[model samples]
Target: MMQLKWEKEGYIVSDDKTLLQMGKIEAWISGAYWAAGRSREIIEKSIQHSLCFGMYDKDGRQIGFARVITDQAVFSWIMDVIIDQEFRGKGLGKKLVECIISHPDIVHTKMGLATKDAHGLYRQFDFEMDECMRRPLL
Candidate 1:
């Protein structure tokens, strides 16, 4: 399991699935525009298949989350990044993403993500807009 700590702030970013709080994760994604109406079953399945990251404060309460679908070699697509409402604007989201991209398993892969309005955030990590296309399954 990969773990990174912000010693000064007592915040941790880890890839330990056992530390993930499913209810909180489901609620966060269910409320997001891109994943609104997503079922808990689907969320669980996605987390099972993806490399997951969970962020927690000193008290071990989950406050943010993200996941990556990757081959761990060539490509990594980051998804479901959210910072708990109360923790927003504190730079925790940025730190979560930093830990994800810097993880040894996927750091060298080309990273990608689709965001409705977080272009600025992703740009800070050197993710650039590209001519890419996607197809919505019927």
Candidate 2:
């Protein structure tokens, strides 16, 4: 996997290994969902099956992430994206999605993601609801 590095407001993503940055990642997801009156099961599942990316402070503190789930052949689901409570209202979320959509594993496949409120942000990448994609890679 390629190292995660992208620049955002008041932060610069680094070569942080997001899977190992579990505390921050968990905080990001758990807090975001709870504020929306949802559950952390989404965060737990994200840790298990998603390619997670962390946005870091200049000092390397993780502040944000988004996850992608894919078979590396047919479909990639961009899911459960969140930035820290201290770090919203900027375009950081968009940057995170762009990074995942452009990741080496996910870019080549058709992408699918479910969002309840961020349709405008995702539409920038042409993401829309579709059938659960089904097929085999050749």
Ten-residue region with minimum lDDT total, candidate 2: 30-39
Q: Residue 65, candidate 2: how far off, in angstroms?
A: 1.2
Tell me the spans in candidate 2 whose CA falls farther than 4 Å from its real position: 7-10, 14-20, 34-48, 131-138
Would you list the C-alpha lDDT of every candidate in the order shown?
0.91, 0.69
TM-score versus the correct structure, for each prediction: 0.95, 0.74
Model 1 pairs whose backbones collide: none
Q: What lDDT score is found at residue 14 in candidate 1?
A: 86
Q: Which candidate has the highest lDDT of all? A: 1
Report the C-alpha lDDT of model 2 over 1-138, residue by residue, as the tens digit: 566666756666543443347766655565564335335565666567767677777777677776677788898777667788787887887787778877776689988766668889989988876766656636
Which predicted model would earn the best TM-score?
A: 1
Q: Clash totals for all models, in order?
A: 0, 0
